[model samples]
Target: GQQVMQIPQYQHVQEGEDFTTYCNSSTTLSNIQWYKQRPGGHPVFLIQLVKSGEVKKQKRLTFQFGEAKKNSSLHITATQTTDVGTYFCMFSGGYNKLIFGAGTRLAVHP
Candidate 1:
């Protein structure tokens, strides 16, 4: 069995502060996907990281994958209330099985 471990189960940040979440997998991943779930809403796909040592940015958000392809991180700079949500890292196993991290819940205060 494979597992993905996510750190900082919960995060509280001031409006304009930075926040980050880390994910590590027991096995090397072919690709990893990030998701965001707003309060009372279902998870929505944010981005996917496929290459080793890859980095991608979307506005104030940045994503990185380890060279070993066993770890990943998401960082949000200048956090805003709009960024308040739960972030999840996921990977697909064979046979269409998808495994998700425990998720990091973020709270932003203005």
Candidate 2:
């Protein structure tokens, strides 16, 4: 199926919680893009890094570009229920058809 599924498909946390998800790809990817999908909102591009050994952070989130570029990672600190949504990572290929990783769902409590 060429899909990567993360463990604990679902996660629930209190107002201040710690959450994490892992993604592994079948093949090497050129570029990795991360998107956040709100309950009723569309996928919005958060950030994109093309260079190897690249790292970027926004507020409470951290992103890393693997040295091999075949994999990547994202981490969040002090998660809030407001962070509820599915996060997807898209891999680029020859046909331009993006291969998306099974989304990681995060639910926070208040």
Candidate 3:
């Protein structure tokens, strides 16, 4: 079994501040998926990182995958109220199994 560990179990940031969450795994991962779950809402897929040393950005959100493919990070620049949610990093295992990290809950204050 594989496990993903995420740091900063909780984060509180001002509306214009930056926030980041780290995800690490002891084993190499084929791909990593990021999801955002808003309060009282289902999880929505954000993006997936597959290549080593890959970096992707969507608006103010930045995603990076480590060169070793054993780590990943999600950073939000200039946090907004809409960014308040639990961000999860997950990897798919064989047989339709998905392994998820503990997740980082973000709270934004306007």
Candidate 4:
């Protein structure tokens, strides 16, 4: 079975600091997706990567997929209070099943 895992289960940073989280898969993934969930809120899709060694950025956020398609990472610059949330990496596990990573919870304090 394919599975996704993430590191640094939790993170805390002062406002304006930077944050990053890593994600790995037990098996090679056809594609990977990233999401952000604000406290007490639902997960919101951030982006999807289909090509190996792909990199995408949105404002202060950056995402990268490994060349092997077995790992991924998200980096955020200049942390803000609104950025506080749990980040997740997900992959399709066949049969319409979605495999999700443990997620990385980030906290930003002013």
Candidate 5:
């Protein structure tokens, strides 16, 4: 069995601030995927990192995979009220199954 763990179960920030979340796995991952879920909305895939030490960025958001494939991180710059949501990191466990982290809930205020 595989599991993904995330830090800072919750976060609160004023608009225009920065935020970051981390994910770790007990076992090396084949690949890792990041997702964001808006309030009362389903999760939306953000990015997937497969290669060791891979990094990807989308606008002011950055995603990184550890060289050992056992950890990952996401960073967001300049938070906004619209950014209020839960961010998740997940991994495939084969056999049509997925292991998801506890998730980081971000609350942005104006």
Candidate 6:
């Protein structure tokens, strides 16, 4: 079975520090999607890329689409309590059954 593994499952960081999350898949993917969820809120769309070797960034965050589309990574330059949230990456090709990567939950210390 195809599956993605995320490291640290969760992280706790102090303000003004750096944080990172990694996503890896057992099989190649067609496209990957990232999302963020607040403490008590639903996930909000952050970014999505389908092309191979695609990369995107927003402020202190960087996203990468693996050349094989089987893996991806996310990096944050600095950590802030406001950055507290869960990040998820999904890989799917079918119309009805969208496979998703394991999510990484980040926690920032104040």
- TM-score of every model? 0.98, 0.85, 0.97, 0.96, 0.95, 0.90
For model 4, how many clashes?
0
The prediction achieving the highest TM-score against the true structure is: 1
Q: CA lDDT, every prediction? A: 0.97, 0.76, 0.95, 0.94, 0.94, 0.82
lDDT minimum window of 10 residues, candidate 6: 93-102
Cα lDDT tens digits for candidate 2, 1-110: 45554445677877666776656666666778888899999988988868877889999988887787767777778898778998877777657677777778788888
Q: In candidate 4, what residue range of length 10 has the lowest lDDT sum? A: 90-99
| Candidate 5 total steric clashes | 0
Cα lDDT tens digits, model 3, 1-110, are: 78889999999998999999999999888999999999999899999999999999999999999999999999999999999999999997666889999999999999
Question: lDDT at 15 for candidate 5?
Answer: 91
Instruction: After the best TM-score superposition of candidate 5, give how far the Cα of residue 70 lies from its true spot, in angstroms.
Output: 0.4
- C-alpha lDDT of residue 84 in model 1: 92
Candidate 2 to truth, TM: 0.85
TM-score of candidate 3 relative to the true fold: 0.97
In model 6, the runs with Cα more than 4 Å from the true position are: none
What ranking of all candidate models by lDDT puts the best one first? Answer: 1, 3, 4, 5, 6, 2
Give the alpha carbon lDDT tens digit for every residue of 2-101 in model 5: 7888988999999999999999988899999999999899999999999999999999899999999999999999998888999999999786799899
Candidate 5 residue-wise lDDT at 10: 99
lDDT tens digits, residue span 1-110, model 6 = 66777776888888888888878887787888888888999988899888999999999989998898877888888877878999887767567667665677898878
lDDT of 4 by residue, 8-81 (tens): 89999999999999999868898899999999999999999989999999999999999999999999999999
Q: Spell out the clash pairs found in candidate 3.
A: none
Q: Judging by TM-score, tell me the better candidate of 1 and 6.
A: 1
